[model samples]
Target: MTDCDFLVVGHGLAGATLAYVLRQRGYRVLVFDPGQADSASNVAAGLINPVAGKRFALTWNANELLPAAASFYRELEQCFGQQFFFEAPIFKIFGSLDEQSALLTRSPDHPWGDYVASLATTDPGLPGVQAPLGGAWLRHGGHVLVRELLAALAAQGEREGWLWRETFDWTKLVTDPTGARYAGRVQARHVICCEGAAATQNPYFNWLPLTPNQGEVLDVECAGLSSAQVLNRGAYVVPVGGGRFRVGATYRWPPFADGPTETARQELSGRLAAITEQPFAVVGQRAGVRPAVRDRKPLLGPHPTVPSLSFGGGYGSKGVLLAPRLAGLLADWLEGKAELWPEVDLRRYAALYRPAAGS
Candidate 1:
């Protein structure tokens, strides 16, 4: 008999949530993670915005994903007796009158209108903010305390003897139709890789187009800023309590590198400046590579030939808002309770998989 029903690799948002869902479904799970400080989930601001981007369009599947995310995190909160999800309004400061008019015109009739809490034609009266063109207060938006949630899950997993603090070694993994064995000591009926950006290097599934991108964020102390709401202009300033805010994310593609860069710090600082005139001091900076997919959709499902091996990652910047719901869907698929949605199913890319030499 296998030691566990599923062995999950990586304890970031994707793996942690998947493991929890599986366990709730009565499956024994073992999560392996070395707790990499630079993992994308750890560095993410955990911002949950239903509307985003230059067009300010509703996020894909926002209607379903947002509610699922809230319920999942709330259940975890009740289970752990610790709060991780924070619901607050996001103030989207418009850069120009055209932008303001566009949202004002569409918000009244568009489906995205449901998420618009209010709109202002004049400055929203936010201190230290530059919003001459006014803005929109988007409801159902907030940030998650990601690290805290991960820690709580890990603590519980550790206490239950299901969490292993070690890096997953590909060479030590053996898989077949029946199951997978790790280092000849742990046997699991199935193995799922949730390795974030690192999955691009996964020998079995790297053939899929996993475009990892580097992103950076800065932690700053802005004394006058309101801690009750998120301010979004070109860059987002998320209040993290005690007058400290997480300001981020500069996106860089290709030629990815590790560690924070001075260029990114300056870019973030500049964006923060554009958002607010309040004096602030940069206290910290973090950098991580986001596991983005070619089509900007999450990758999920088992290897074509190796049924025992599976993958669940590439949620990109939307991991926090998307992981929980997708985790449930993945668990459902695993138990043969339902089929994966066609778009996210790995079978969509089956033609791209070419067996490695000597495989």
Candidate 2:
């Protein structure tokens, strides 16, 4: 058995980022991943949009989260010596004059307007594309190659003797006043559950509201297409070099399953047609289940009754943009450097966990 400072379960964006943060803070960390369920971060394109939607509104907490995510990922890339994060601008293609008019109606001096990188009254003349109404370039918008990121993060952890490739068992977990013992193989000061959707089944964190949302994306090869900016209207077409683009993703509530559906592929292809007249060949399609909360806030902080247990999950689609910042916050809280944000605190939903009406 080996002792450590922190044991993180689930190597998805949530777990991996938290492990990286804790490791950076000089904490002895061990990470475990059970490939028993779908991970939303695996197939995530990692697109970070500042100004989004038809109204060209800023993404939630863009002003603060954007810069933090930017610097955080940049430093990670340099530290890991991998080409994982791509800094690119997203172009919001206008479908109609009303869309453009409504966007212009908002004062540029507004706080949200700071994220609008730029806009053009006329089309930017992207080849094989039909943006007759032009589009706007959003700043602080980019993507992290999630698959590469997780792999690189795990490799780094392994190099530091902080990563394990095995399934963590709940029955073997025993928590005392000081720390936790896992199957007598690993001992840790705290056991944080970053198990994504599987957190819904965790005995310690199961009470928290976690909704599984399924999303799908298609990888395609198109010749003679510009490999510059990300284009978005109803769907997004992101160039991944070599004239290939990863276009996706269909967001469905009450997800039927965590697998690619024919319906989603057809829907994505249909939407991709709006980006350009150029025909493309579909190479592959993938899907994963994202962990979302009822209030759309992150699920973080230590277990209410177990000080040696902690949790960080429910990042949903914004995992790339939210994970770094949230991990820092959680790490700080764990080290007694800060308090957990009320919006994301697990205690907020304790009422549901408590026995009801004098049971």
In candidate 2, position 322 carries an lDDT of: 93
Give every collision pair in model 2.
none
What local distance difference test score does each model get?
A: 0.91, 0.83
Instruction: After superposing candidate 2 on the true structure, give the runs of residues whose Cα lies further than 4 Å from its correct spot.
Output: 35-38, 108-111, 355-359
The candidate that achieves the highest lDDT relative to the unseen native structure: 1
lDDT of 1 by residue, 1-359 (tens): 34999999999999999999999989989999998877889899999999998998889998889999999999999998989999999999998889988888887686685788888989877877888888988999898999889989888888888998999998889988899898978999999999988987888888888998999999999898777789998888999999899998989997866689999999999999888888999999999999999999999998988989999999999999999999999999999999998889988999999988888
RMSD to true structure for each model, in Å = 1.3, 2.3
Model 1 residue 195 CA deviation in Å: 0.7
Using TM-score, give the best candidate's number. 1
- Report the alpha-carbon TM-score of model 1 versus the true structure: 0.97
Provide the TM-score for each candidate, comma-separated: 0.97, 0.94
lDDT of 2 by residue, 1-359 (tens): 89899999999989988988898888888898854334689888888888766666678877778888888888877987877778887888888898877766764656575677677768899887778988787776888888887878777767767777788888799998899999878889899999898887777777889987889999999896666888898888888878899997778877365478889999999888988889899998988888989998898887777779988999988899999889999999999999988988878887877532432
